[model samples]
Each structure stands twice: as structure tokens, then as C-alpha cells.
Target: MDATIAALEELTPVSSSFAPIDDSAYIRFARTSPGTRTPVLIFNAIGVSSELFLPLSLSLVAAGHSVVLWEYGRVGDDGDTFFSRVQSYKALLGHLRAGLYDLGLEDCHAVTLCNGASVLARLQAELPFAVSRAALISPYFNLLHVPHQSPYETALVPLLMKAATDEGGAARFVHSVLNRGGHAVASKEALSKAHMASPRSIAGYSRMLRDYRRHDETDVLRRVKGELHAFYCLDDEAVSTDYLEAIRSAKPSIGLSTYAGGGHYGIVDNPSLLADVTAYLGGDR
Candidate 1:
């Protein structure tokens, strides 16, 4: 247990604070020390807590940029309403915007991964304070376009529930999601974090997988005004090449960074990928 705590401490020493989105819910957020440039906001994939992005956060902080890591709102089963969900999304963004305001940042760069990328781009079109620039890692513009995909093809609720309660289940799920292409391995810290996730969070991820097929960001992408950068992992199983190709075809101006070796999560931890992200955020590219 000492070793595990030490490992997690090395990964993410900074702790998180609660930022309220409403009376009933709040987002878990953590910020690193300010860097030479504007702060960066990082959004994780479904079922992936802010802890998963600690390596990236550490890198950004080392590069002299403050980084913010946030988890999405929990979706409860009792009062599930489409309108309520939409409002939650809006409130979440407002909460994020508030985080920036509290930090005294007029504008900052956004780094979003997987489904979070889609969510950010969609909300950016409607938000009052837009990100100055954005970096996307293994993004999905449309969940339906992923190869061999279907609506709720994977039973995430039960699996995540099991994972939350059992260390072995958490290890299995973490390996399947994070360690892809036989390149990445699940860290003990990662597994422990997965096992400690709240049931509400697990339900939220299940709901996202079940309903994400209905929300397409094509129109939102067209209207997005910020300078955009996308990183694609060739071996990532969860995302599709077709969706990226379609995005590139539709938006010719968006910059793309492809990694032949790094898997989805691995790419975020790669030094080269981090350099590219920092460059883009710094307007050096």
C-alpha cells in the first residue's frame, strides 16, 4: 500500500477541489502550478477520471503551464431527462468557464481526449468564453462511425460496477481500455483509481455510451472558430479512422498529429506527443 500510494503521488501530487455546477452536484477539478503560458484545460474520456491524465498534467506543469483536470457530471437513474442532461452539459461548461475566471485567465487552451473532445467542440460553439486554441487526443466526432460499433455494444454499467467494487475487475477493465496495441500497460495507480470510482460515475459512463450515438458534432465542428489540433493513434481500437478522415475532409484547416506507435492513452504520455501539444498551445506550430 505504501508503494502504491507513492506511485500515485509521483503521478499526481496535486489534489482536487470541488467546483459546484448545481445544488446537487459538483465537478472534481485539480490545477497544477502556472506555467510560462496560458492555463490548459484537460477533459478525460468516459469512465476515465481526472487521475488518468496526471502524466499529461505533470508534463504541462513542467513546461511552465498551469493545467486543469475535471471529471464530467454524474447522471442519476432516478431523474433521467433529456432536458436535464442537456442542462447538465451546459452547466458543466459554465462551471469550467468559472474555473478559468477564478484563476484570472481571460482565455486558455483546451486539451480533450476521446468523447471529451466531442463534448468540448460542441459546447465551444455555444459558450461565451471560447478557448484560444484546442488539442484533441484520439477524439471521436461521432461514436456511431467507430468500426464494429453499435449503441451500447459494451455493457459498461455492470462492468464498471464490478470494477468499482473489485480490484481484479478494475485491473481487467483498465487494461482493456488503456493498454492497447500491446504497447501500453496498466499501472497499479491507474487500477486503484478505477476501483475507487463512485457508482454515480460508473452510471454516467454507461449513459454516455448508450446515448452518444445520437449526438453528432459535424455541424458544431463546422462552426468552431478556435485553432484546432488533433492527435490520432493508429492502433486505438475505440476510435475510428473513418471519423477522423471525415473530420479532415470537412474541415481542411484542422491540424492533425498522427502516431504510428503510441496507442490511445500511450500517445498522451509520449514525450513527442506532449511536445507537439505544447507547441500547438504555445502558437509555435
Candidate 2:
């Protein structure tokens, strides 16, 4: 366990340069191998910061792929930024594109999870650089069609914020949401990492949730020129089989894989999933 932690910590250190794209946005991303042309760009799940992606980033690096981890500014804090979904997406996407250029990365492969996939699917036609391949893990492309949550969930926002502020509440909440809740220490650690995101950004995520729309899947898929690899987890609560079927119908050419038991967060640490991603990035797909 100590060795694993050490390895993840060593993936990208603070000594690496973090470039700022604008006053409201910055990206702390670095390429593991400068000469390696095919970079793996990670589109982290919304509401969760880039820090939580360290383990997966480290694993990808170990498998001989350059990785890019990124996040954007918080909303409602900047008058220049509005509380719109497109505004949020533009911010994150802009920062990442600028950061990649600054880091001398192009012709990359992208790996996205959950809402990140949704954003990527919508912006597939607008990417600044060429993409060789793209992988979607438990992609929740149809956010509007997902099973509805309790209406009371919004009312409990204050309580949820309170829970996130305390260690025990945060742990319980993380454990409950994650597929691998049995790992208590990991759950707590994840909670700690999530706190790295600013409150304004978190609030913006809530706003995004309230205002999300279902994009035209067929049209979006038609715009994507790169090879697509999609993974669906058997135990993911956030994404359903219907979602997968919808995507399959829209983009039949996409390479699809399913895991028996990796909830949304499980794939982040699953060795087989990491290996598959590495293979795809390495053009073995």
C-alpha cells in the first residue's frame, strides 16, 4: 500500500510547471514523456477536481503513455463567467486546449468519465488538435433521461455541504456513492481530494446539473472522426443499460466493453481497465 501511494505521488510532482490560460482558469498538467507524441488527455468527471485522477494518471504513465489532467475555474465567483452549462464547458475545454498547446501536446487520445464524456461528445467537432482515439468510461451521455433522483435531493444541499465539511460525513457520503465502498481508507482519501475543488466550482456543478440538456447523439457521433472505445460498468448507478443501448444505436462503429463490477469510481483503479486504455492509446485497439 505504501509503495502504491508512493508511485501515485511520484506520477507528476509540484515542481512541474502549471500554465495559466486566463485570469479565471489554470491547468496543472504535465506530459510524462515530452517526446512521446500520442498524449493521453484525461477529462475528469465534473464536480471532482483533477487531484482525484492521480491514481489513474500514474497507472497510465506506468503503462508508457503521456497523460494530461486538467480542471477549470469555479462559477458564480467570476462575473465574467455565467452559470450556464455551455459557459462551464467552454471554460474547461478552453483551459485544457490552451494548456495542452503550452505543454507542447497534440494529436492526443482522450479518456473521459461521466459528465466529462457528455461535454466531450458535444465538443468533439471543436477540439483544437487531432485526436487518434477517445475512450468513454461509464459515459452518461443522456443526462436528461437518467433515472430521476428524489426531489428532496435539492433541499438537502445545505446538509450535503455540511456533511462534506466533516470527515466522517464526507467518508460516509463517498462510500455510499462509490462502487468500491468496502475500501474505507480509499473512500476517505477520495473525499479529501474532492475538497480540493473550490466551493464556487462546486456550486457551478449544481447549477449545471439543474440545467443539463440531452444533446443529439447521432449528430454528435457523426462529427467524431477518431476511433471510439466505450466502457460500461455493470454496477454503475449513474448510468444505465438503456444509455449504452442508445449510444450503440447512435454510433454502431464504436468499440464497446463492459465490466462485471466496477461502479463509476471502480474503473479509475481497475488494472484491466487501465491496461485496456493503455492498449487503445498505444494503437493496439
What are the per-residue Cα lDDT tens digits for candidate 1 across 147-210? Answer: 4332222433346445434535453664355334543333424522432233333344434444
Alpha-carbon TM-score of each model against the true structure: 0.69, 0.69
Displacement of the residue 153 alpha carbon in candidate 1, Å: 7.2
- The numbered model that scores best in lDDT is 1
State the weakest 10-residue window (summed lDDT) of model 1: 75-84
Residue 22 displacement (Å), model 2:
6.7
Q: 11-32 in candidate 2: lDDT tens per residue? A: 5432245656555444455445
Candidate 2 residue pairs in clash (backbone atoms < 3 Å): none
RMSD in angstroms, all models? 6.8, 6.6
Q: State the lDDT at 191 in candidate 1.
A: 28
Tell me the spans in candidate 2 whose CA falls farther than 4 Å from its real position. Answer: 1-25, 35-37, 73-87, 143-188, 195-201, 214-218
